[model samples]
Target chain A: MGGMKKLINEPADVVSEALRGMGAAHPDRLKVDLENRIVYRKDAPRAGKVGLISGGGSGHEPMHGGFVGLGMLDAACAGEVFTSPVPDQMMAATKAVDTGAGVLHIVKNYTGDVMNFEMAAELAAADAGTEVLSVVTDDDVAVQDSLYTAGRRGVGVTVLLEKIVGAAAEEGRPLQEVADLAKRVNDNGRSMGMALTSCTVPAAGKPTFELAENEMELGIGIHGEPGRQRLPLAPAKEIAAMLVDPVLGDLPYQQGDSVIAFVNGMGGTPLLELYLMYNEVQQLLDRAGITVARSLVGNYITSLEMAGCSVTLLKVDDELVRLWDAPVNTPGLRWNA
Target chain B: MGVENFTNWLRDAASTLHENAAYLTELDSAIGDADHGSNMDRGFAAVVAVLDEVSFESVDELMKKAGMTLVSKVGGASGPLYGTFFLRFGTALAGAEITPATVGEALKAGVGGILARGKAELGDKTMYDAWAPALDAYDDAVAGGADLGGALAAAAEAAAKGRDATTPLVARKGRASYLGERSAGHQDPGATSTTLLLESAARTLA
Candidate 1:
């Protein structure tokens, strides 16, 4: 109700100051350009390798920016909280990371993000003659009527897409192949989210929306965009069923279909609840005869201190599992580094 | 009018946005991510700053610079949509005489850029909802032998009506569309801002 009890010193400086802290904290792996709001892999521009870049608004930490490293994204442009990055930052990132092999953009299909990236790509091609390929992720199952809405909102699958496609690019795959792989990951992934509370934008200094004490919003998006419905507060298992069923149905994951099941916390929810939700999710998938080939649980993509969780089911094959298992070192995610 | 008129329009719009920032944010909070007010205010302030330092040789150059400033400074659907509007508006006005018909053409061209960027249709509960009506009003007034100020005044009035019309229609574009039926009762922030810019033009451009 009063000034948001956030750790930020000023509402305007949250994104920049956070970048400064990120720079200091992970100097070995990342080089933060505070002025341009770009986080780069320290040893970027690896010749003969296609560059990988993704970006969106801030508040969803360890995504886009945090994924920039050895076997992941080459660069990420950070925007204001819940706002898309402007073309200037994107243009610079595209130019900075483009080795001769060209650069591939992994964008989430939000209106602002899509348009700004399109303008940046147009500018890059027109002025500098740089080759740029873009694949926008629209994997959320929340938007039921895609014919009436702005397709499906991109949610949790973006994290998986960057890692998988980033690994493909690290194999010296050409731009077209890398782009196609990113798109493939996008098409195969499906996500559904639910929020227990609303998040406050720093400048707004209040909750973006509200929910009654005994209510929760289902089909939520990352930035606190309202989901399909609000229902009475339910238990962890019931909530998990609500989140997982839509994802399973949307992609129509058949029996014997193996998948990477991810149970992610919205920034405010605790890890304990996520793990509990994961158990329910696994049991549901088990009943459906779908095998959980791989699993990730935690706050990989999140809204700002919003209490909720999203379930993402990526129908994966051996190729996806292998790429996702590739060695990677970054601040937010590191495996077999 | 010359570049000074555009400079004034941007400055005036900046003040208006700053004044109404909280209201816009409130509207967005209902159906969107609650940053439209701040984004528009920030983008227009940048445009005003550019006007203060850079002297322009032509109205087209001035408008193009404003568009580039908004594109570079603002981040969101508003940035590209408004930025493209100004850019195309300026492009259409290059070296042309400032007649009522030419301004109407420029307005249409600017709105066209918005449609191309957003891909939103009428009754989509977006800025285009306000724009479609405003454009029609501008043409009708121009055809009725109205002066430039009178034509823009009519357009601004129609835009206001369209902005009010967005309150009951469900959103079909942008972040608000995610709410589906829940988005119906909230006035679209983009449409509200579009009307503000048109009203500012009525006050300054004419």
Candidate 2:
């Protein structure tokens, strides 16, 4: 197998084993429904609080699952590596998390995810009469209709939206209001990702694709799909510029615009390189005269062990900045109580 | 054709998928997430287990159980697509006596369910590429007074041709479509697997 060595005991057991570890590691903060493969807050379905749910393939650690708690998602359904969760799991999560106010499904813009979530929402509505709203994040500017063939993909912006919208829900906003805030976040945000190496899906027992040591994939998706373009590997500054330019140009963030700058690492990347990339990204933003009102730098969303990073810039006003600063206590991200 | 032949068909499909699992995954590696073979292999294995565990009175009952097994066990796009295909096919055949013409109708309904679920059209370079032509050929054979075995043979041949025809076509759907022109020149994994299903039907359903 031509890939990084994984610690998994068996390929089929990876997701379930990881879920078990997560439940043990964070007993007080989160609860695991092993049968449904859902990760829920310890005290989910907060009365009158609109529940937030997001899920996707399993490789992206600390994403939907790691973000579940205090100010983020109420629950997250996990699928097998690089596969969308089935509708039965999502429907179970939806009914489990709905607090009678409503539930919101934060879906990434992948075909399987979209279809499965849509089916779950319909089932939830028919079975329990739970009002469910969905917002699909499609902020990746790398491949629009042409390259992706599935409009634009949701990327780094999903983490920021989950946080911001989670805050709005925490304040007891109605489902519609919280969903609208999520849409605003998605609309204002644009992201671009690039990969230096391909990630392995465990069951496949190898890397999804291969890249020569001297080459890199630009505009890559989180699933390890090939990017829009491949080029010779460049320095951190050039890579940062390559990621930032499209994000800024696609949304046309202008001078004096306040924005949240997120520099996210794919799973295999280290913080040292992320900080280096962030430093270059910040300089580019400074030169463009866009004010970075809030910033996040880490591996918030990932593609197995792919070595790369994505940049998301969301134009924000004071309200979003306030929400971004709100207290969030989760396994992955934490702030003041 | 009777329920015994259908049972044998399911067993043969499991064997065929097991034999071709590596090949399917290899094709998927070129244009998709590289799990099609393993997913289908695991799903059909589960179906065989279910087939061994219980006896069903009707063909629809057997097929529905297999479809449910696929939906629960296979955890990718193929899980839902192929699962729905069998479920709808079985549903269309509910309480009906097995016949060549009815098999053609059941396949048509099954492929239609895939279209409704995956929403891919002709020339999208997906399983529909093979399914649409295979269904047409089956219908044509049945209309010409061919029996179940003859129609399935025609369908399997058409599906194989359609699977080969997928090469050199730009994908417009599924994960492969993300590669744009790069997706060309690679045979689609879904079509390959669809061909396998048809070939098994031709061999064992007769």
**Candidate 1 wrong stretches, greater than 4 Å:** none
Chain A: TM-score in each model: 0.99, 0.98
Of candidate 1 chain A, the 10-residue stretch with the lowest lDDT total is: A1-10
* Among all candidates shown, the one with the greatest TM-score: 1
Of the true interface contacts, what fraction does each candidate have? 0.90, 0.49
Residue-level lDDT tens digits of model 2 in A72-168: 9999999988888888888899999887999999999887788778878988999999999999999988876744376688889899999999999
Error of 2 at B80 (Å): 1.9
lDDT of 2 at A137: 96
DockQ of 2: 0.59
> Candidate 1 docking: what grade?
high
**Model 1 C-alpha lDDT per residue in residues B65-154, reported as the tens digit of each score:** 899999998899999999999999999999997778988999999999999999999999999999999999999999999988899999
Clashes of each: 0, 0
Model 2 stretches with alpha carbons more than 4 Å out: A1-4, A146-148
